[model samples]
Target: MPRLIYDYTKSELERVSLSPDRFRRKLKKAVSNLLPYEMELLQKWLVFYTDNRPELRQCISELQSDHKGVC
Candidate 1:
């Protein structure tokens, strides 16, 4: 069965909250796993999630232009 977005989002958030490296890794994994609509929702959530995290914001900004994959 496919994973539920809520569970995936929650688990990944907890897993990557500590560092930018982990956050980037998990974001890539999420991008690969989720459908386009799911990814869009995830991106929105990511903006709120990363809003206060300068390291994560920097990491995201450094992603390739094609994969600017998050908000």
Candidate 2:
């Protein structure tokens, strides 16, 4: 699953989202400043991220299965 809405690359995602905390911080910053298209992209990213990475969703969700968003 991609932690970012836009996949610059696998390496980029890995570099940016190195830790859960870091990922959340980045995600919050991003959400605070989103382009219109990016908002749409984020919706897609959420679907993919959650679908492909349940543990990631769980971790960010603090083990709440129904919770959403990274930050």
Can you write out model 1's per-residue Cα lDDT over 1-71, one digit (the tens) per residue? 34497467657766778988887777667767777777777667667877998888776566535486443
Model 2 per-residue lDDT tens digits across residues 1-71: 23353554323334655476655555555555555566467656655765666545554455223334423
Clashing pairs in 1: none
Question: Which residues of candidate 1, in runs, are more than 4 Å off?
Answer: 1-3, 64-71
Residue 69 of model 2 has an lDDT of: 43
Candidate 2 local Cα displacement, residue 37, angstroms: 3.1
Model 2 scores worst on lDDT over the 10 consecutive residues at 62-71
TM-score of each: 0.75, 0.49
